[model samples]
Target: MLPVKPFRQRTGYCGPASLKMVLDYFGIRKTEKELAVLSGATKKQGVQDGEGLVKAARSLGLKAALKDKATLADIRKYIKQEIPVIVNWFSVNEGHYSVVVDIDKENLYIKDPEWGYTRAMRLDTFMEVWFSIRGNVPSSKEDFNIRRLIAVEPHKPRRGRAKKK
Candidate 1:
């Protein structure tokens, strides 16, 4: 299993919370409040787009890549490398963000911030929800057409930080 820290978002802070989970896995401790400010998220209006999430991750010195029209293979590749991915998909007729931690032959393990737990779903089911968007507009049933994917890669830590006295 990937070393992902599960976090439940506060109000409309799902973006920040998801990013927080990724940051935590890299040994970077940052509060959701700080991430909200970095991502230009407000109490009333949370992160507006994937760009906000990219900007927030970049601010912390992590490499954040936003992929458009990402495929299931892309997600599986990242999971194989032990990198959790933040995916924007619709769940329960609502637009949401969650972390994809593991993928087996038949199922995908998702760490949903809103639900505060890891849920498993078949690959076909995940794809249906992930790509079910209407035109370019985002609604309850179909949220956004682009199907954006965010992958946060951590930089290798320097090895000379501690010296023997």
Candidate 2:
């Protein structure tokens, strides 16, 4: 008999799984000393971008779910082996980092409202972004973190510099 689990039908998102482990895994307010330990070697390096953890996870095998259409079982199984997460450091107005969460109806749930990239998204629209990021889904690097619709005001810069500077 197959094992029955809660949230069995929903396609659990891998984004949060890996991210949760990444940020929350280590000690809070990590000192430069502590951060150095994570980076390896014994050198006091200034805040390196948070890309390292996400990069390492991909090497281990974590992928994104397309169209917000992934199975909770599949995600759970994946997480059991290794957590999947996304690393986003794009924030001009808000925090650069955010963890992707679940999807319901058509909106992609996310942690940290500051990013303001994906206030909300349609399932179909998000899928396209997801697929676009990785080219294809369910890959050997099956787990992936996606950066989608990050609102960068390309026009705003020009707005302030009007009338010929």
**Among all candidates shown, the one with the greatest lDDT:** 1
Across residues 62-105, which tens digit of lDDT does each residue of candidate 1 receive?
A: 88999878988999888877788998787665456789988888
Tell me, by TM-score, which candidate is best: 1
Query: How much is the lDDT of residue 58 in candidate 1?
Result: 90
lDDT (C-alpha) at residue 94 in model 2: 20
Q: Give the CA lDDT, 0 to 100, for residue 30 in model 2.
A: 24
- lDDT scores of the candidates, listed in order: 0.78, 0.31
Per-model TM against the reference: 0.84, 0.31
Candidate 2 lDDT for residue 65: 30
lDDT of 2 by residue, 48-161 (tens): 233433343333343323222343343334334332223342233221333443445556444442332234445565454442222223365443444432111121222221
Lowest summed lDDT over 10 consecutive residues: which window, candidate 2? Answer: 1-10
